[model samples]
Target: MDATWILRLDAVGDGPRIAVKDCMDVAGTPSTVGCRVIAADALPATLDAPVVETARRQGARIVGKANLVELCRHADGINPWTGTPVNPLDSARVPGGSSSGSAVAVAEDEADIGYGTDTGGSVRVPAACCGLVGLKTTAGRISTQGVFEFSRTLDTVGPLARDVAGAALGMAMLEPGFTIAEPPTGTPPPLARLRLPDVDPALDAAIDDALRTAGLQTTDVRLPQWRSWITAAKDLASAEGYWAHRHLLDRSEHLEDRHAGGIRQGRDFTAAQVLACRRSGRAASAHLNALLDRFSALALPTLAFEPPRIGEVRRGSMTYLTAPFNLAGLPALALPVPRGAGALPASLQLVGAAYTEESLLALGAHVEAALAANRR
Candidate 1:
């Protein structure tokens, strides 16, 4: 119930191996999207999704199709039909989803990198849980063509890897010409430390310590509309997700009742409700974008708290920390910082202006280097 892979290639051969989340189409492979109903009638994809095609063009081998939360609806990565990917760092904890298996594959060293989709922190949450580097590129930065749809408005494909360097490499393969620019003089870029309410105080302290250890200059930034933005994004994603998977309602018997019920709620949302979210999302994006203009990136915790054990997951908590940036259509990178000798690390997230992934990765790599130095 914790973790299990969906499918593996017959032969991966040489070169970098990538484990793709089953939601993305791979030539000649079934993209079951971790749903038994879809897999039961699935056929091999005739062509790779544009994102997967980039990986193939870069000579990366597809090692397997990673499992995910059923319908990509849950954050706990518990798929009743397909097993969830175990959290390599701590099996007792939930491997964040819907990109759960992608994180597991990279954390377990079974693949050089894992390609995943983050529509509400699907990539970043799992990366944080598994102690890997996950990047959620700005909306539309990486094409989602040929990939299974869920929240077409919010879904963005990205990479999850073991470290900052590996993450950058993964991004390069995913988007030709994507590069992590070095700091002007090998120092971390200026960061705007966001002050969010109601997060675990310990995690907040850990973030402060990491920034201090990195000697990264930061200014406290507070947002008054943070909660509203998160709520609007969640509703927007649900509405869009329903439209993308509405056909599944015909075979609702095959899905878990909870998942089906959520979709049904989306269907019931009034057009006015959906429109209000759209307007609020844009306003939220503008507010964040203006802040990014003053600072290179906005820094925060990827998850409000560390992942809880399976079956104890506090649903919506992880997504609450991650989905707002997706609403802003900004790039975010999550990197793990050591918590203690044997403690689960806390992930630091850096969100950048639209299409500023290069800056975000540069900041992440610097923070990573700084944390390593402090550890030594």
Candidate 2:
């Protein structure tokens, strides 16, 4: 499949219109949320979600919906309903999801910017795999009224583009009164690097070299409790997802296979576990904030390794490097850096404090420019 859907943008004079992830509801468009069984009753939304409305008002055209993983659960894109979106950089590799098609649309130049929802690296993972820019905004920063609920606490709508500028532009349109703050052009401050243990060494070296070449200072920071934070996030997600869809599971059999399995697993979460998970979430957030307070931004590999083969994702070996931030409710930007030994695209992730998207995007733009110059 070409994986490109073109639509006439009523607002933009002559600009290209791009496809959106299916989880987002567009008035008069079907939102199966990647379930073939639910595709039949998928009704057109009567109203556009806040982000979509803002984009439309700002001259964005309504393009067809993009494809995604079933229920927006998995990191590796394997939508049994619509099939996985092809990773343009490497056809055999998975197009990290559940925002699979959104990233691919931008990577292929089918659209300048693709609207996407990132719960746990959905936007960043695919963008990294496809050699693009993906932004995961702070929780509750962008409105999620029209988007399908996965994990209410973790869900946030963002954008994917081939460049930082494009991503920023898309964000500005979606968010009200968002201003792109320019980074200081002179000698920039040092870029803080987190020591991600158990990550791919070659990927680490490439990113370190890239930061040094960009004239940013690199420091070693340790986050020993990152794993605990991830656990809390998973627990909270399971409980919240179960709450949101339990009724649907009771009344209908429209969920796709993996989603059906997820619903079943969600049902296994007890009320006490759900409350305990929420408590853990709060504690984890507090700890993460303390750690982030010391640095301007934290840097890590977008993924531990390169994109895995599409078939491997179906078997469930690889998850994603981007999920931790979703739980932390921070802003993260993924920028393509260089390929690894396998010649697959690798990316650098820059994470900032909540509502600090302007700063993060500014820093990302500088890093992107520096990388391009180094390549030349």
TM-score top scorer: 1
Model 1: runs farther than 4 Å from truth?
1-3, 11-13, 185-189
The whole-model lDDT of each prediction reads 0.86, 0.77
For candidate 2, list the clashing residue pairs, or say none.
20-66
Question: Which sections of candidate 2 miss by over 4 Å?
Answer: 1-12, 185-189, 248-254, 314-320, 340-342
Single out the weakest 10-residue window by summed lDDT for candidate 1.
Answer: 182-191
Q: Model 2 compared with the native: what TM-score?
A: 0.92
Instruction: Estimate the TM-score of every prediction.
Output: 0.96, 0.92
lDDT tens digits, residue span 1-376, model 1: 4355788885455767899999999889888888878988999999999888888888888888888998888777777678767788888889999899998989989888999998989999999889999999899989999888888788899999999889888998898787898685655447899999988898899999998888888999889898898898889988888888888999999998978888887887788998898888788789888888778788889988879888888768878778988887888999997889778999998898898888788888888988888777
Task: Count clashing residue pairs per candidate.
Answer: 3, 1
Q: How far in Å is the alpha carbon of 158 misplaced in model 2?
A: 0.4
Local distance difference test, candidate 2: 0.77
